[model samples]
Target chain A: MNRLSFLAPVALIGALLLIWQGACSILHTPEYLLPAPTAIVLALILNAPILALSAWRTLAMALEALVAASVFAAVLALLVSLSRTLDRAIRPLAVALQVTPVVAIAPLVVIWAGVDHPDRAIVALAAIVAFFPIFSGAVRGLTSADLDLERLFDLYGARPWQRLLRLRLPSALPFIVEGAKVASGLAIIGAVVAEFVAGSGGAEGLAWRILEAGNRLRTAEMFAAILTLALMAAVVHLCFQALEKRALAWWRGR
Target chain B: MTDVVAALLAVEVDYPGRGKALGPFDLALVSGEIVALVGPSGCGKSTALRLLAGLEGPTRGTVRRAAGRGETSVVFQSPTLAPWLSATANVALPLELAGVAKAEARARAVEALARVGLGAAVNARPAQLSGGMAMRASLARALVTSPRLLLLDEPFAALDEITRRALADDLLAIWREARPAIVFVTHNVEEAVYMAGRVIVMTPGPGRSAGETRVEAPTPRPSGFRTTALFRDAAEAISDRLAAATRAAA
Candidate 1:
């Protein structure tokens, strides 16, 4: 049932794209205004080097931001959770960051961090945006443990570190995986949005390249870059999804 | 002539939100003795086992044991096996927790599994186990500790009659070998009569030992013991006492 349900969306997406191209052709839209799927494919193939290079830059920034955010969030959450008063203070702040629009503040983040190191600025913004879910997930996972199991460990006179390693961490793995899955996608989106708002000079991500292509009325080029971003997002998403499944296998086995 | 085996020197428990102390009273769970503590629900039978197992602290008083150096092990009513680990690992949990090396623990866990007649089930996870199988694994785990005291909290209450009898027999075999002072808790009078050398019936509220009955059946009590007149007499007596207590509680 699940396998069949999963395939339904792929079939639907193909049908939707076919209809979109058919409608555009029937309307006789110019290539500059609305490029057919073939035109976008041709542009992507021709400008593969430039587009791929720019995509690499954005991918690199997003990945760096993701690693930094996950590590920082996990560590900070661990430390903050140790103190109840501090957890209470930080939880609301973390939630506020999750709710606030990163898009709205992208230009300000670029201006304040200086446009020269826009990749760094974009990464920092992405880090802030990505950190919250990991922080929340890790904290929830760390805290939710069985009291009976805890007592059983205590009965054995087990050390705190032993209990944490054997029981608490295993229990929290699913939550950690869930947080990372959500964080990875957001990291890529954050980096791309920041690039669009800040506009890179030479080290621009594909987002800025797309804007440049659009401003010059290179619609097919714009579509090609958008296609690359979509592909990258899908790839990152699939990676995290696989990781989440593998990480939670033990829990699911139970 | 012999040293005191297991003694509760004025032990009492009080959890502020949950309930009150069960006893400041005295009792001895002597070596090689199976002392069944029978009581109604929420009468502190479970809590008493927890305290004896050192899973919880007594608000006041002390629980003393005969062993010079050995970990106490418990068999809970529900098999609280780690769902992730296989049955063998679940049975090996005490050894692992005691810092016995993994390969050694697993090897020893195999011996314990064989004793519980779960030799084929050692690799199966808790999810793959039936209620009876899970309980048997828990019994294996408790015995593997080689404790001076083996505390059981109605460990067989959930099993079917056939499996329950088989497990009871296995428990007795383990008890005979290990010779730990077994403090078994249950509400079943027949089980107490069949398993224990002595049965202590507790009064319902804030539970305490209401009466003690001795069962002087010989060693290695056989399968036929359950049908014997002596067993019937012991069970009937305990049942009458329990009925009176329940009536009083009501």
Candidate 2:
């Protein structure tokens, strides 16, 4: 936003980094236990190629999950909206799915999809965990339109598809965008958790990297992968913001 | 076929929410005439207009029409301009929905906007518009169809004195050019007198037609005639009739 606000987070982060380094240096802590900022930076740099490949793989999975989740959510939302009976029948099931821990089902998903393309099962798990909000938010938003606006369409003799395309969809975009913002982070979390289980439930993802680093006492390498996930989250958030602005620029400054 | 032109032969209204019968609304809405339905709030004045527009169904009795949808257009009290649409785009929606090409509909929308003194505000969205500008857009949308019947539900009730009078004048000019059967609703007695050839006083709740008073004003009625004895007389008479109707209903 403004200079002061921008500087605030950076200042806080710099202070935290300084504190971490100072605490480690004073305690004479071993590098493996609490790595210094410089050591973390060096570890990140040295493992660049392998880390980059893993980072790309994770990014691709997040994107794939996001797209699949959104499409599935939209179709389900539309279908539910079109039928009162179906909405009643499916709402409880949806609520249950939303509340159930994806971590609990990670083993089951791995067992079902198996290790042929283990990442595919992980991606599917990620999509399931992230899709509910988009569907529910979109359905609610589309139906929240002022009743008078709908009546006006009828008075003007607009047909069903025309009303949906011109009015309902546009009205739902903001809600859908908000849902996507929330799902972005969750999707990555889902993929990582699924990867963790697939190793136990029996393949590999960034979670494997975190486990490998932890076992080998490579804390900085673990932090590097963690940083990559954080960066991916930030990128996804930025992408949604840019897309929302592009779609709704006409409503800018409202 | 009965050629009883310029009539609403015992129209009635109902809805699930508004459970009871609204009105057995009888009126002699003549051609080339302006009638004002004056009543308290929720008195079925707008409901009568809705029935006439065929937007709502009557529980009993008929809302007789001379012809189908092409014969009428309605202007709601709240402007009702589509918020997501620009002024020209909102006005053009009706024509476009009626199978007109986008360009032709927009052209007519522009012309209607000019008539309502909003020529320069074509690209402005409803959110950017003042109440008067948005109302003008609503009126423009109604007029663009060139219908034989115009249903206005307290169209100027939300405006200040200056804008209301300006809109009244603009509407009268448009009426003269188009010569539609206009049914204007209002709570303001003076406004009813200012705008209409006939003022129909209505009962307050569970409404019915109280009485109708005919004004002998000249065609394309003078906007300044609001200061004249005729206007005062009409307003006072309508007020008396409204009071009487409310008393009778009570």
Candidate 3:
């Protein structure tokens, strides 16, 4: 059953690509409009080194931003769980950050961080976009500590720190992993969008490569770059899924 | 008689908006004695257990514990095992919290699990265990600390009849060996009489102790004792008190 489910998507993608290639050839389609999969594949082979470098840069930035967001979210969640006052004070600010689109704020972030540190600005933007899900997940997990377990801890006279470490943190892990799966994808998006606003000059991120290709009317190259970005996002998501399975092995039993 | 392990002196609990939840009553638990609190659903049997465990403060009066905080343990209605942790790790949690070295705590946890007949399942997480096994793991956790006083709130209420009887027998064996003062809360009159030396009946709603019955059944209560006439008589007497208490409350 699992093998059939896995093969189904691969088969569908192959059939769609075959049709796209056939249609493009029979119609004598212009290359600048919608390049055939073959043309995109050719572009990918020709610019393999540069595209690989750009993909790596984008992946690095997204990963860094995700790590920073997770750490910041965890610490914030710990504080929020520690006190009701902190939760009341910080929850609105977090909500505001979440609702505010990263695209709308990216330009301002780049300008504020100054021209010398475009990478920092992009990383910061991605971190902001990725922060809320992890924070909310951690808070929910922490607060959901079992009442019966808490009472047992009370009976044993567990210290506050002990309770936080032994009970609350372990409970929060699956939730944090859940949030991370979502935030990992968002982090890549934030990085790509921020790169778009910042322009392609320094460090030529994948997003910048796409914009450069578009301006030069290198449509096949643009398609190739977009494909690279999609692959990067898929890889990031798959990595997180693997991590979730490992971390929650006790819950999933596999 | 042994010294008093704990006492509730004219204790009553009132929720801010929910009125009186329990008491304006008193009781004492003697060292090495097993006491059961039994009543209808709405009665504050659990509330009384919470007071004894020091999980909640009485609204009106004092609850005094002769045993120190570390000398008390509680088993709640659910097993409450941490899903991520192995049975040994779950059982070792109290010792770990108290700063015992990891190896030492784990060794003690293994010993406790063995006592509950869960020696082979020590590495299993809660999800991997059957209902009876999970409850045994929970019981192991409670006994691991060798507490001077143990508070249990309907610990067997969720189990099948066979599992419940087996666990009750296991609990009796552990109690005999360890001799902790125990306050067991349950709605099962048979269970109350089967496990406890004294059964304290409670009135319904704004609960307080209505009456007490001493079980004359011999110690190390024989296997198949549940079918015996003596056990039935004790259960009947406690049931009568419980029925009267319910009627009086109405």
Candidate 4:
């Protein structure tokens, strides 16, 4: 049953790709407009080296952004948990940043991060996009410790740091893992959208490749790049899912 | 004179939004004695336990707890073990929090777990344990520190009768070894009479002490003591007081 469940999605995707390829051929569609699955595969093989480099660049940016966002959010969440004043001060700003579209802010971020390092700007924008989930999830997780356990800790006269390390942080693990899963997807998207906003200014991620391909009507290459992005996102998601399973075995056992 | 481990002096707690939850109540726990607080739901019995554990302050009176760091331990109705940790690790936490070395704490935790009949399940996560086993782990965690004040808020209320009876006996055994001033809150009159020497019955919400029954049985009473006339009489007396308190409130 488990094997069949796993095979179902693969089978569905294979069928869809076959249908798409057949439709393009039957309609005599132009390759530059709507590239067939076969044409995209050919483009992928033809441009493997360039596509691989660009894919790596994009993946690296997303990963770097994810790490930065996770660290910053964790520290900030810790501060918020420690101090009511900090929580009151930072929460509104976090919400405001979250509510404002990342696209609208990308241009300003790119310029401020400096035109010379579009890579840095893309990473920064991605980090911003990835920040809120980790921050909010961590905040909720840290503060949402079991009340009975809180009293137990108090009875022991546990130091603040001890409570955090032993109780709050362990309780927060499932939540932080969940936030990271959501943030991983957003980081990829933010990097791509920031690449678009960064324009053709030497930023060399997969999104840049897509833009370059589209301008030259290399639609097959564009499709190939999109497929690569999807694969990367799926892989990243799976990594976090595996982590949640391995590190939080006890949580699921409950 | 008995060594007074802690006292609640005219402690009245008025929870914000829920006025007059407990007391002007008074309680004095003597060292190495087991007392049970029994009352109906919303009788502020838990509030009184919190007061003794130093988890909450009185709104209008004083709570005196002499216990310092790692000197008080509490077990709630649920096991309240950290699900991420192994049973040994959970038991070791209070000692670790008190700056004990990890090796020493873990070794001591294993010993404590063994005392509570959880030696075989030391590495099990809380989620993996049956309710009875989980509560035993909780007992180990509570006793690992050898606390002067051991507070239990219905620690075995969720267990089946057999498990509950077994735990009650095991707890008494551990108490014999290291006699902390045990104060547990429960709604069960028979359990109160069985486990504690003195059972203090409280009035309904905004509770004050309604009555007290002293069970004349030895510490770690002999097997089948629960069926004895002494236990029966004490249980009935407390049950009558609880019923009267509930009736008066209505």
Alpha-carbon local distance difference test for all models: 0.82, 0.80, 0.90, 0.91
Q: Write the per-residue lDDT of candidate 1 for residues B1-250, one digit (tens) a residue.
A: 2455667766778778877747765577667788899989988788778777766667788888655334577777788887778888877777888889999999899889889889998889888889998898888887787887788889888888888878878888887787887899998888888889899998786777789999999756865898899999999999889888878979
The better-scoring model by TM-score among 1 and 4 is 4
Given the true complex, what DockQ would model 1 score? Answer: 0.42
| lDDT, candidate 2, A10-50, per-residue tens | 99999999999899889989988889987888888888787
Chain B TM-score, all predictions listed:
0.93, 0.93, 0.97, 0.98
Candidate ranking (lDDT, best to worst):
4, 3, 1, 2
Cα TM-score of candidate 2: 0.90
DockQ of predicted candidate 2: 0.43
Q: Model 4: per-residue lDDT, tens digit, B1-250?
A: 3888899999999988988899889999999999999998898989998888777888888888777656888899999988878999989988888889999999999999999998899988888899999999999999998898899999999999999999999999999988899999998888898899899999988999997999889989888998898988888888888888889989
- Each prediction's interface RMSD? 2.3, 2.4, 1.9, 2.0
Q: Whole-model lDDT, candidate 1?
A: 0.82
Docking class of 2: acceptable
Clashing pairs in 3: none
For residues B186-243, could you state the per-residue lDDT of candidate 2 as single tens digits?
9889877778888888887667887788788886676578788888888888999998
How do all the candidates rank in terms of TM-score, highest first? 4, 3, 2, 1
Q: Give the per-residue lDDT digits (tens) of candidate 1, residues A1-254.
A: 99989999999988988987998899998888888888888999998998888889988998899899999998878877578998988878888878989988887888888867787789988898889888888988888766666666777777777777777777677888899899889998898888877776545788987999999999999999999999988998999998888766666454
Runs in model 4 deviating more than 4 A are A1-11, A250-254, B66-69
Which portions of model 1 show Cα errors greater than 4 Å? Answer: A1-11, A29-49, A80-93, A104-108, A201-203, A250-254, B1-3, B9-11, B19-26, B66-69, B83-93, B96-103, B120-131, B203-205
Q: Between the candidate structures 3 and 4, which one is better when assessed by DockQ? A: 4
Which candidate leads in TM-score? Answer: 4
